[model samples]
Target: MSLREVIAQMRQTMASLGGEAAVLLQRLAARAIRGELRRLAGAGSRVWTPAAARAVVDRLRRMLVRLVAQLGAALGKALTSAAATSLADAALFFETGDRALLGHVLPLRPVAPTPAQIALAREGVFKASLGRFGALLVHAVEGAAVATVLLGKPHRAGVDHVALALRRTAAAHAWELQRIAETEASAAYNAAQLEVLLAQDVPGDRMMKRLVATFDSRTGRDSVLLHGQVRPVREPFFDSHRGHFYMAPPNRPNDRELMVGHRPAWGEVVVDRWPVAEDRRAAPAPAATRRVPGQAIRSAKNLRAGDVLAAPGRPRIASVAERGGRIEVRTEQGLLLYFAAGAAIGVLAAS
Candidate 1:
C-alpha cells in the first residue's frame, strides 16, 4: 500500500477513539515516519543503511512505551489491568529488534487507600510478615532459596510489574515488624511503671499522677516540664527522649514561673517521667496571650522533641503549667504530635 493510504487509514482509525486518540495517533504517526525514513534512505545516493533505520525505529518504540506506561500507572490499578492488552499492542507497533521489545512491559501502580484502609492494610502487612518470617526462618536454616529471596531487598524482574510488587511487599514487612516491636516494648514499660507506682510512699492519687507524668516524658510530650532530676535511660523507639524523673519535669527557661504556679487539672498520663494532660482545660488556668497565625517562632536552642526536659533532680517531667517562657505540654501515648507556633499551649478562648 502507498504511504498516503497508510497515513489515511491511521488517521481514520485514530478519529474513532475518544479522549486519548490524539496521543495514540501521535504514536502511530511516529511509527509511520520511522518506516518512511527507512524507505527513503535506501532510494538516493545518500541512502541510509538498513541497520541505521532499524535503530531509529527501535529507539522511537522504546520511548513511546515508556510514555504510555508512565501515564497509565497514574490512572490507578484497575486502568493498568484494563489497558494491559492495549499497552502490549502499543509496544509491538514499532518492532525493529528484540532489545526494544523487551523494554516495553509497563509497571503497574498500587491502588491508594483511605486512612482506615491504610490501617487495615498495615494490619494485613503485619500478619503477612509475621507469617512469612515464622514460616521462612526455619527454612533459611535448612538453606531454602525462597527464604533468602523473601528476606532480601527488592530485585528486578523481567516485567517491571513484578519488581514493583516485590518492593511494596518488602516495605510492608519492614513497617509491620517495627509496629510489633513497639507493642512489645510498651507492654514491658507498663509493667515496670506499675511496680514503681506500687513501691512509692506517696498517696494513690499522687502515685497515679507521677505515673502519668513519667509516661508523657518518654512519649512525644516534649513540652512537659521535669521538676526534679530526670536522666536518660534505655532508648525507646517511639520516644525522642527517654528518662526517669525524681521530682517533676523542668519548665522552659523563660516560662518556669507561669508553669510552676498553674496546677495540673487532672494530673497527667506517664510514659516514663513525662506527664500528659488529661484535658488541656481540666485544671483551669488564667486566659493567656494567644499566638497569631503565620508567626514564626524559634525552637528551644538545646532541646528537641524527644529530649528529656527535667528539673534539677527529677527523673521525669514535672506537672508545671509554665516554666521559663515555654509551656509544658503532656501528650498521650502513641499519638504523633506536631508542635507549631500557634499550637504550643492549647489554651483556646474559654467558651
Candidate 2:
C-alpha cells in the first residue's frame, strides 16, 4: 500500500479510539480548569457553582479539539520515522494524561520511574541489546574466521578481545538507550505537561487532582492490610509530588508487581496486577513492636538463622539469615530489611 494510504488508515484507526481518548482528555481539561477557577476564587473555597461547571464543560469541549489535532500531528510524525513507532503506539494506546508523549498535549502527570521502574527499563535495554548485538557478533566472528583461513595468515594465537569490545559497547549502548527511554517515556513528557499547564496560568500542582489507585494487590507484611482482603488508596499510593508514587519491589524491578498511585483513566476494574498500590502503609515509621513488646534489639550480633522476630508497625521478621556479610531480616511481607553489625534496629523478639 502507498504511504499515504497507510497514514490514512492509521488516522482512521486513531479516530475510532478518539471517543475513548476524548472522554479522558476532556475530563482532564475540566479538572485542570476547575482547579484553576477554584484557586482564582481565593481562600481554598469548597463551593461549586453552575457557572463554574459550565466553564469546566466548555474547557472539556476544547480538550476534544486539542486531542484530534494532537492525534493528527503525532501520527504523521510517528509513521514518518521508524524509531518513533513504539512511542506512537504507546501514546495512542494509553489515551491518558499519564502518557509521556513527546507532544506534551495534556497536563496531569505523575512522577517518573521509581527505582523499580528504572531497573525494569534497564532490563529492557539489556534484552534489546542482546537481540541486536548478539546477531552482529555472530556475523563478525564468522567473517574473522573466514579471513584468517582464506589469507593463510598466521594464527594470531592471542586474545583478540573483539568479543570483549562488542560486549562493552553493548553495555554502553544499553545504558544510553535506557537513559533515553526514561526521558522520552516519562521525564520529558511530565515536564512538558506541567510546563503547558503553568503557561496557561493554572495552578499546575492542584489541577493534578486525581491520584489513581484502588484497594488491590497482595501487599507483603510490610504494607497496610487491605480490608480483610484489601483497603482504600488514600494512605498508600497518593503522593504530594507528581500526584502519586510508584513502588516496585526492592529486590528487582519487574513489571508484574509494580505499585502505582493512580487509577485507570477510564475507570474500569483492572484484571492485570502489573500496576498496583502496594503501599504496605510503607513501613509505618517503624516504631515499637506491638506483637512482642520490648523485644527490639540493637545489634545484629545475636541474630541467627531460623530465628523469628517481631517489631512494631512492621511485619514479623519471618526469619533471620546471613547475607552479604549482614543480617538479612526477612519480613512476613516479603521484605528484606538488612541490618549491619552494631546497627540500632527496632525491638525484635524471636516470634
Candidate 3:
C-alpha cells in the first residue's frame, strides 16, 4: 500500500476512536457520580436517620463542587494535552504522507509538569482542602445539634454543653483543622482521582461515626454494631490537643460502661464512672520505671513478647504477646488488645 493511502486510513481510524473516547469518558463520569452517591447513602444510613442522610448527601455534593472548581486548571491541562496530540497526528498526515511520521509529531506522551507547575497544582489542592475543612466543620456542627436533640432528654444541659464545646474546640484549632483537610486533599490529588475526596470511608467519616456512637451510649440508646466495624473505643481516642481517652467497662460503683476522659483542655465526656482508689492501685507503673539503658521502647513496632504496656486510663497492665505490623497486648483477665499499625503504646516495662 502507498504511504499516502496508509496515512489517510490512519486519520480515519483516529477520528473514529476520538468520538468513542469522548462517549466513554462521559459514561464513566456518570457512573462514578452515581456510585459515589450510593456509597454515601449506605454510610450515612449507619449513623443518620433518613432526614439526616439527605443532609449528609447535600454536604458531600457541596464538597465535590468545591473540589471540581479548584481542580479546573488541572483538568483543563489534561484535556488540552489530549486535543493537542490529536491535532498533531492530523497535521503529520498532511505533511509527511506516512503513518510512521505520526510518532514524530505526537510524541505519544504528554509534557511533564515543571516544578513551578507542581507548586501551582499543590496550591490549588490546598485551596480545595480549605473548602473541604469548611464543609467538615459545618457537618460537625450540624451533627452535634442533631445529637443534642436525639440524646438530650434526661441530660439536656450536659448535651448542650458538649455540643457547644465541640464547636468551640473546632474553632479554636482552625489552623490545625485546615491542615488535616489539606493532607487529605493532597492525598486525593496524588491519587489523581476525585473519588478519594468524595469517598465515605475517610477519617472524617469515621469521626462522625464515633460521634454518633458516643451520643447513643450517652443517651442510653441501643446501637446496632455494623459488621466488620471496629469500634473506636479499642484504641485511645485523642482530641485535637492529643489528650487521650480510653473506654472502660462498667465498674462496681456505677455499673455503667464509661468512656473515661482525661486532661481538662479537651473538655471531658462526663460519665458516671469516677476514678476509684483501686483503679490507681491496680495500674502498672509508668514506662519510665521500666526503661533499661538503651532499650527503651519508642514505637509500637518495637514491642516484644513479655513486655508490660500501660493503656491510657486503664488500670490493668497488658502484656505484649505478639509484634509485627500490629501489636497484640493481652491482660491477665484474657482481654486481648489489638493496636493498629503505628498506634502509640506506652511501655510500662521492656522485657
Candidate 4:
C-alpha cells in the first residue's frame, strides 16, 4: 500500500481504539458498581452496614486490579495486526486504606520491546499492515532499533531492506500504543472515583446515620462522607450528611438526589408541594413520644447553662448546652450549638 494510505490506516486504528477503549472502560466501571450495589442489596440489610461500607472501598481497589488487566488485554488486541502487545503486563496495583486511596501503574520503558511487543513490531514492520515500508527508516537510523531491541539482532539479514527515504513508523506506532493504554486506564479510574463519590452521598440520611454510627465518634467520619458527596450532587441538597437533595425537612434548600430516576433538571422549578412543615411528613416527630417521662422541655429562655437539650424530631442525642438563646441541636456529633436569640431554637428539660 502507498505510505499515505498506510499512515491513514494507522491513524484510523488509533481513533477507533480511543472510542472503543473509552466506552469499554466506562462500561466496566459502571457495571462493577451496579454489581456491587446489587450484591449489597441482596445481602439483606435494610441498612448499609459497616461490612458493606468497608466492602464498598475494598471493591474499588479490586476493580482497579481487574481494570488494568482488561485494559491491557484490550490495548493488546487493538495494537496488534496478527501479534499482541504486552500492555497487559504493564502491572498496576492499588494501596487503599481508611483515609487513603492510592493506585500505581508501573513505568513503561517501551524503547526495549517485550517478547510480545517484539512480535508486534515484527507484525507491524515486516507484515506491512501498519508500519509499511516507511517504518524501516527509524529502525535503521536509531542503531537498528527494531532489529536489535525488538528482534534481538542487528538487522533482519535479507528481509529488512533499509530504504533511506523511509520514515520511523514502527517506533511511533509503539509509542502511540503506550499512550493509548495510559489514557484508557485513566478514564476507567476516573469512573471508579465517581462511583465512590456517589456511594458517599448514598441518598438517605437515615442510612447515612447508621453508616456513621458504625465508626467510633472519634473518627469524625460523618463529616468525611458528607464532604465527599459534593462532586456528584447536581441540584441543591439539604446537607452532605443526609444526602437528600429533593426536600430537606428542617430549614434545608433542596433538589437532585431526592428526585432519583428523574432526569436531572439542574435548576428546575422544584418548589416543595407545601410550605416547610405544612406537610405532616415534614413536621417533627411528636415531642411526647421523644421525651423521657416527666422531663418536659421548656422554652429556650428558661433553660440554664448545664441543661439537657433536644430538638423536636431527634430524641436520640441530648446535648449539655451553654444556653439555648435561639437554636441548639445535639445531633450524632455532640458539639455545643450557638444559635441566634429568638430564633425558636431548642426544647430544654426543666432542671
Candidate 5:
C-alpha cells in the first residue's frame, strides 16, 4: 500500500491500544522523528530509511495528541479544563522524553579524523545509518497510535483506517526487529544450540536426568534447571529480585495465575501469556521427549540452547556455554558450575 495508507492505518491501531501504553507510544514517536531528521541530513536520502520512518511516526503521534485534545474540546462539559490541561502536559512529556531518548539511549559517536576528514566523514555516515533504524521503530509506533485514536472505531468500508495504520506500523516494526535479530543472531543462536546438544550427549554417574533452561526476552537474562523435566505453568510465576529475568504472568486483575492445560515446568521456557483464559484443555506435548514436571528421565542428545523448554512456562533457553564436553552454566542463584555431557535430555521447544 501507499505511505499515506500505512500512516492512516497506524493511527487507528494506537487509538485502540488505549491506557498508558498509548501515551508511551506517542512519546516515542516524537523522539523517532528527531532521530530520523538527523539521519536524513547526514545521508542526503529521501527514502524511508529508519530516519524517514521515524519522521512519519512523529507526524502520527502529534496528530493523535491533537485528536485527543479535539475530542475533549468537543465533549465540552464532559471533559473539564483540568483534564485537557493534564492531557496537554502528557503530550509535552512525550516530546521531552523523546529528546532525552535521542540524547541518552541513542547518542551519535564521534570518530577520529584519520586521513584528514575522510575517515571522520565515513564514520559519521556509518553512525547515522546504524542509528536511524531504532529511531524509525520509535516513530512508527507513536504515529500509528495517534492516527488510530483520531480515526476512532473501524467501519464496514473494509478495515478501520486507524487500526489498519497501527497494524501496518506495528507489523513493519516487528518485521524489522525480527530481521535484525535473525540476521545477526540466528546463526550464532543455532550454533550455540548444537553445542548444547553435544554437551548433553555424554554419559556418567552425577549426570543430570533432565536439562532445563530459562530465559527472559525483555532483559535478555537467563537461568537453567540443570536436571529438570519440562512442566506446564500451573503455579504463580514469581518475579526475580536480581532483575536479570521477569516472571510475572502478564497482568490479571484476579491474581489467578493463567492456567490452561498442564502446568509449565519449573524453570521451563514457555510463552508468557497473561490473563487466565476460558479454556483449560491441554494440547499434546511436543515431540522433544520431555518428562512431566517432577518426573525423572534418562539422557538424550537433541536438546539445545535457544530451543524453548516450554509447556506452560516462562519461555527460556539453556543459557549456558557448552565448551569442550561440559555445559558451563550459571544457576538462578547466580552461581556458576559445570555439568557432565551425558546428563541432558532432548528439549521441548515452542512448536
Candidate 6:
C-alpha cells in the first residue's frame, strides 16, 4: 500500500480505538460512582430518621458531581499532547514500514504515579469522609427526639433510646465512610491507569499485544513487532521526572539523538531517520534561556527560542536561546553557533 494510504488507515484505526477506550472509561467511572452512592444510601437506611438518610444521600450526590467534573477535565487534558504524539508515531511506523521508528514513537515505559496524583486521591477520600460525618451529625440530635416519640416512652426513658439510636447511626456512618474511602482509592487508581493510556503507554504486556494485533488487522499486515529486551538510555538535562529517553540511532551521531519513548525494554527500535513535514508545526518552544557552549548571535523574529539548528559540517544539535537583543545557540555537547541576525539557518523539529 502507498504511504499515504497506510497513514490514513492507521489514523482511522487509532481514532476508533482511542474513542472506544475513552467511552469505556467514562462508562466505567460513571458506574463506579453510582455503585458507591447506592451502597452508601443502602447503608444509610439503617439510620433512625428519614432526614438523616436524606442528608447522607445528598452528600453523596454532591461528591459524585464533583468527581465527575474533575475526572472529565483530567481526561481531556491528558489526551491532547503526549497522547496525540504517541498515536501519530504509531501511524508513521505503518506509513514507512520501519520498526526503528517505533523506538521514537512507542512509549517504552509506564510512568510511576505522580506525587500530585497520590495527594489528590488522599485529599479526595479525606474530604468525602468528613462530609459524610458532618451530614450524619447534623441530623443525629433530631433523630433522638423522633426515636423517642415513635417508642412511646417517658421523656427520661427516651434519652436511652436516643443514645442507642445515635450509637447505631455512628457505627453505620463509620462503615459507609470506610467504603467511600476504598471507592475513592479505586477511582484514583483507575484514573491513573487512564492517564497512562492517554500518555500512549499501555499498562501491561497483554494490552500491548492487543494494540499490536489491532494495528496489524487494520493494515492487513503482520510486520509489526514489540521488543521487550532493549533498555532505553535517559536523555540528559531534560525532565528526568518525566523519565524521557533517547533511543540511539545506529549511524546518526549522538547529538542527533531522538527523545522518543519513555521507559526502556518496553519495545524495539525500528527506523533511524526523523520524518519532516511541511504541514507540521514544531512542538511548543522551550521557555527558559540558558547558556551552553554555543556561539551567540542577534535575535530575529523568525528564530524561536527552542528551534533546533544544524550547520553544514556540525553533527551536533543546537538550540536557539534568546535573551533581550542577544541570541545564543548552544548544543548539548557544548558546541556554539555564531551566526548573524536573519542568517539562513536550517531549523530542525523534535522527533
Using TM-score as the measure, the top candidate is 6
The per-candidate count of clashes, in order, stands at 61, 19, 0, 2, 36, 9
Superposed by TM-score, candidate 4 places the C-alpha of residue 64 at a distance from the truth, in angstroms, of 4.0
Candidate 4 per-residue lDDT, tens place, 131-230, comes to 2212232334333222223332222221122212112333334344333433332222222222222333434411111000111222232222222121
lDDT of 3 at 125: 46
lDDT of 5 by residue, 1-351 (tens): 322232223222222222223233334444444443443334332333344444545655565454334322222221122123223332332234334333322211222221222212223322342245444544556555444443333222112232355445544554333232222121222122222222323333111111222122211111222212212121222222111221221121111111111111112323221111222233222234445664334332333445443223433444567655545543333333344445443234422
Model 6 ranges with Cα > 4 A deviation: 36-351
Model 5 lDDT, full chain set = 0.31
Scored against the true structure, residue 68 in model 2 reaches a CA lDDT of: 36
lDDT of 4: 0.30
lDDT per residue as tens, model 3, 235-283? 3322211213333221111112212112121232222222111222332
Span of ten consecutive residues with least summed lDDT in model 3: 221-230
| Candidate with the greatest lDDT versus the true structure | 6
Model 1 earns a TM-score of: 0.22
TM-score, candidate 4, is: 0.24
Task: Kindly list the per-residue Cα lDDT of model 2 for residues 1-351, writing each as its tens digit.
Answer: 322233233333333332333343334434543454343334233223334333433443354345334433332232223112323432333343234323234433433433233333334433453245334434443343333333332222111222233234434444333332222223222222222223323332222111112223432322221111111222222111111233221111111121222223324323232223334344334334333355555456566544444443435556777654555555566655545444444444453
lDDT of 3: 0.35
- Compute each candidate's TM-score over C-alphas: 0.22, 0.22, 0.22, 0.24, 0.19, 0.27
lDDT, candidates in the order shown = 0.28, 0.33, 0.35, 0.30, 0.31, 0.37
Supply the TM-score for candidate 6: 0.27
Q: Which structure is stronger by lDDT: 5 or 6?
A: 6
Q: Candidate 1: deviation at residue 196, Å?
A: 3.7
lDDT of 6 at 105: 38
Residue 56 in candidate 2, Cα distance off native in Å: 65
